[model samples]
Target chain A: MATSTALSTTEAQRRRARRLTGEVLASWLFLLPAGLLLLAFVFYPLFYLLYVSLLHWNLIGRARFVGLANYSSLLQSVYFWQAVWNTVWMTAGTLVITLPLAFFTAQFVHLELNRRLSGLYRSAAFAPYVFPLVASGVVWNLMLQKQGIANWALSLLHLAGPHWLSQGVWPLVSIILVTTWQFFGYYTVIFLSGLQGVPPTLYEAAAIDGASAWTRLTRITLPMISPTLFFATVILVLQGFQTFTQAYVMTSGGPNGATTTLVYYLYQEAFQFFNIGRAGAVSVMLLILLVAITLVQFWLSRRWVNYDQL
Target chain B: MVNSIEPLRHVLSVPPHFLPLHPEVGPYAGAWNSAPFGLFYLNTLFMASAIVLGQLVTSTLAAYALTWLRIPGRQAVFFLILIGLMVPEQLTVVPVFLEMRTLGWINSYQGLIVPFLGSAFGIFLLRQSFLQIPLPLIEAAKVDGASRLQILTRVILPNSKSALITLAILNFIWHYNDFFWPLIITNTNHYRTLAVGLSMFFQSGSGLTPWNQLMAADVFIAVPLFLLFFLGQRYLVQGVMTSGIK
Candidate 1:
């Protein structure tokens, strides 16, 4: 009997081992496509980018080792500094317009407006986002002309509209306005969703205590939806850093490179000038800045981005 | 409104007329015939379909494996995906562009489609959805002598329809309107998608603006998306939430 039991146990263990091996094989087969693609397109390219950043590769002749020369040059380059300035301010500009408007609009519409009206509002609001950036930029390019509708409307209000595409500050502002129009609806929806997640009983309790609307919003709503607020802010900042299309389509990084954001500069350097080494340097810096920004965001979020409730 | 008016207007009138009293289809037809927008439409359709299909397949298989199977180095795969999620395309655009050039994929469909075939966002979205599927159903399938592929197709996928649709719609819209990568990879009118095509058309003139035709083209480009957005707003919004910390 003992011998028979031992034989059965060994057979069962062998079957289990075989099944485990098959499972692992299946898992690997499933993982292979995504794994290979991500590695090839994402991970390997990152290392490749770093290596290229270290060389003076111009897509002509042989690449020579340049070490940190591109980075140092970018530090002193006027165009590079202007590009950085444009990126920071444009992002800040968009955030300034978008955050308050989105938050307030979400609260007002989500709380007070009926569903029918809110749907209409959503359609109008998200239309800009739905419109292709290039196409709209093209349209806005026309609309912002000297005698175009944008200026005409300003004339209606007896206010002067600046030369939107040609002027230095106004070019950036025009980009910001278009971006705000594009993104406000999307962020409002996010804030709306976040607002909805806040428990109604908290509001009821505050109401029972005769809490005013302002007090209720400050004391209850703000703290509860802090996570969503933080998420939106992070996205806004990231989106700012990557603002290329507007500049490309609207300004062509032009009017004396007034609107040349970092990405625009990188594109010109890499493709137009074929300065692959310099572009690679810009890319590496962007990646590092992105990581540093993300880290800083997370570190700062612990201060006020509440996660306790949910 | 002015798109119709511009067709009727004899001059570039300021504060352009809102109503098209003597409207004609000349501008629309002229715009359509002037450029290869038909080909642009086809290229966009082809690229979006290829990318959406490829991303769906890769995201599903990877999500299923990571969720259902006890694979080694699961943490590493997750970490890889997280990095993929965080890194923007521009950060890697230089090297990837070089890679594409080396592969002779510049101005080719391969350049447009291959890089986006595996989306970290899609995989993450699907994984989150898959995690919510009741384990007993999968166990029951296994007990019924179903193969792993059958279980995935018949059992797992069927339950994740909404997530799948959300991803598809989002992917389709995004790639359909994507300009940056397409602009870089495709230089000629032959491979240019609609967004790139329109931008090129706008720049075709040497600062001699074609307002009527441009508006007509812009309207045509925008209307289909407006329809899609109205139809899929719920899915798009849900998809956005998924990308957030939710």
Candidate 2:
């Protein structure tokens, strides 16, 4: 009887081991489809991008391998540096307009209104976000024409509106304006929802302590919403770096290349000019910029992003 | 302000009118009939639907595995997946374009749809949602002798319905709005989506564009997306809030 029992115990142990293997296999099967797709597309292309950046191929036969020559040419090009400068200023301009406007708008909508009114206002504000950038950009192009309503509105204010779609600062400023108009509502919704999550009891406690309105805002509200703020800032900057459709439809990288961001420059190089090697170098530079900025933001986020709420 | 359609002399008057006093569909008809707008709509619908469906199934399964399965190298895999978020899509487009050509998928629906089938954002969001489901609930399901798939469908998915819908709608609308991939992949208008097609229609008249017709085209292109935004606003808001805060 004792020997029979011991044999049964060993059989159970073997069965358990097989079952463990089955579970692990099941888990892998679940992940396999997604893993393959991401590996092939998202992950593989990154390394390929790095590799292609080192090649000197147009849309022709035999991509001749070149080392750092493409990058050197880009570094020396006036047009490339101009694009880099334009992209930087455009990002800074858009963020400056976007974040403050969104925050204030959210505060007004959430704090100064009843529930019904806020809902109506939120939908109205976010409606612009739904439009395709190319389509609205078309409208803006027409509206900024010499006889357009944008100037007519400026006439109503007794201030002349500059030729918005023209070269120099106007084109860059126009792109920023349109981008801000389209996207501020998105950030506003994020901020509004973040604001909603803040417990009212904390506000009441501050009120009881005779805290100034600014004090309540600075001390309680901003700290509580820092995670959302950090998320928004990071997302916005990443998006700003990739501003393309607006520049594409509105200006076509322009009369003097005034509004050419990195992406527009890359597109022009790849498709129009067929400068594949140069485009690859631009892509590599963009990749480095994105990865570096992302890493720095994440590292810096630890300082101020209040996750103690979590 | 052009008050009406295609009376260009009146439409391009010094000051634009607020109301469409002489409301007519002349420009709308012109815009609609001008291009293969209907085909463009159909292409976008099909493409966006395929992407949404593929992403949902793959992301849900992957999120579940990452959350519950005691697999080796899981952390490294997760980190690698998260790297997808850091790299911009534009940076990878060239290589992806080359790969698509090599696969003979250029100008095909597969070219448009395949590269975007797996979304890292969807996986991350769903994983976060699944983690929010109480472990005790999953434990109870397992104790009842439920198989892994059964437990996922019965316990985890039922609880993550909102997150699932959010992922679906977001992916759908985003792909619908997408122009870059389609512009690169499709050399012909046969498989072109609306955004690119619309831009082509606009540029069809390179020097002298019909402003009224262009506005009409813009209106039609925008209305469908506006409808979608309204339908998905609540869940979209919830998804964004959850993704950011936690």
Candidate 3:
């Protein structure tokens, strides 16, 4: 009887082991499709991109491993530096214009009297964000034409609009304006949500303290919404770096490469010139730059982004 | 200043007789007849649908495993998947293009659809929702002899309607408006999506693109998303908020 019981226990243990193995197998099976795809496409491509960045190969020719030659040449290129500068300027310019505008619009829309009107304003504002980039670029192209509505509107103020898309510096400004217009509503919505989360009692208490509106805004609202502001700045900067369609369509990265941002330069390198190696180098630089920026932003957010509520 | 602007406003206003649209030659008709936008629309619909469906299935399965399965090294696997989120598509464009060329998928629907099928964001979103499901409920389902797949479809999914819808809508809008991948993958009008097609249409026929027709095409391309935003603005806002906070 003792031996039989021992045998049965061992049998049960074996059965349990089999079931456990089956469960693990099933779990892996579930993860396999996503895992394989991500490995093949997203993760593997990163390593492959690094490898390709070292090679001098057009699509047709056999890849000749050139080590860091591509990187060195790109670093030496005037166009590459110009593109980097343009990207930085665009990000800074757009952030400066967009953040304040979005904050104010969000504040206005968040007001009690404007509550009913908020939906209308939000939809109208966000309408531009949904338009395909190419389409918006096209519309902006038309709007920024010398004889277009924008210049006509400016002429109403007796300010002659400079050639918006055709001139050198004006194209950069035009690209920034178009990008800001495309993104302002998105940031506004983000800020509006943040604003809504700010407790009304704080504002009421400030009012009872006889605090001025400006003082209340500076002391209370800004601090309360600094987290959102930080979030918007990170996203806007990222979007600014990814500016391609506007420059591609509205300006074609020209009036002499004035509007050429990093991605545009990368595209020009890879597709236009078929210099895959140099484009890969640009891609690596852009990736490192963005990731570094994002990390630094996160680190810096500790100083200013208030997380007291949560 | 107000009095001076009134006359100018009248002059700037579109003339009452000047119609933006005519009876026979509407902007919609003009744009539609001018380009193969119909083909572009169809291709975009097919590609978007394929991407959304594939992402939904893959994300759901992966999230389910990560949440409920008693698998070893699950955290490591989750982190491995999350790494995809950090690597931007722009960074991978050249290598992916080469991969597509090697796989003979260039200008093919698979090229556009497959690489995007497994979204890290989708999986992350779904996992968050799945993790919120009460453990006791899942245990009860198991006691009733419900298989993992059965519990997933019957219990976990039905409870996650909002999350699933959010994923679906977000994926649809994103892929629908995506330009970069489609631009590189497809060389011809055959597989061109609306974004790429519109761009090519604008850039081609060198002298000048017809502004009115292009704007009309833009309106057409944007209408679906506009309708979606108006109808489901709450879900989109919720998704964005969740992403931001998380």
State iRMS for model 1.
Answer: 2.0
In candidate 3, which residue ranges exceed 4 Å CA deviation? A1-16, A113-115, B1-27, B244-246
lDDT of 3 at A197: 91
Write candidate 3's Cα lDDT for A29-94 as tens digits. 999898889989999888899998999988888889999999999999999999999999989999
Docking class of 1: medium
Task: Give the winner by lDDT: 2 or 3.
Answer: 2
lDDT of 3 by residue, B165-201 (tens): 8888878888899998898899998899999988887
Q: Pick the candidate with the highest lDDT.
A: 1
Q: Chain A only: TM-score of every candidate?
A: 0.97, 0.95, 0.93
True contacts kept of 1: 0.73
Provide the lDDT at B119 for model 2. 81
Tens-place lDDT digits, model 2, residues A199-294: 999999999999999998899999998987888898898899998989988888785999999999998888788777778789889988887888
Q: How high is the lDDT of residue B111 in model 3?
A: 96
Give per-model TM-scores. Answer: 0.97, 0.95, 0.92
lDDT (Cα, tens digit) per residue for candidate 1, span A98-214:
999999999998889999998678667666776789987987887788878788899899999888889758998999988887788889888988988999999988989999999
The regions of model 1 sitting more than 4 angstroms off are B8-12
User: Can you tell me the CAPRI class of model 3?
Assistant: medium
Note the Cα lDDT for every prediction shown. 0.87, 0.85, 0.84
**Pairs in steric clash, model 2:** B1-B16, B1-B17
Taking the candidates in order, what DockQ does each have?
Answer: 0.67, 0.61, 0.49
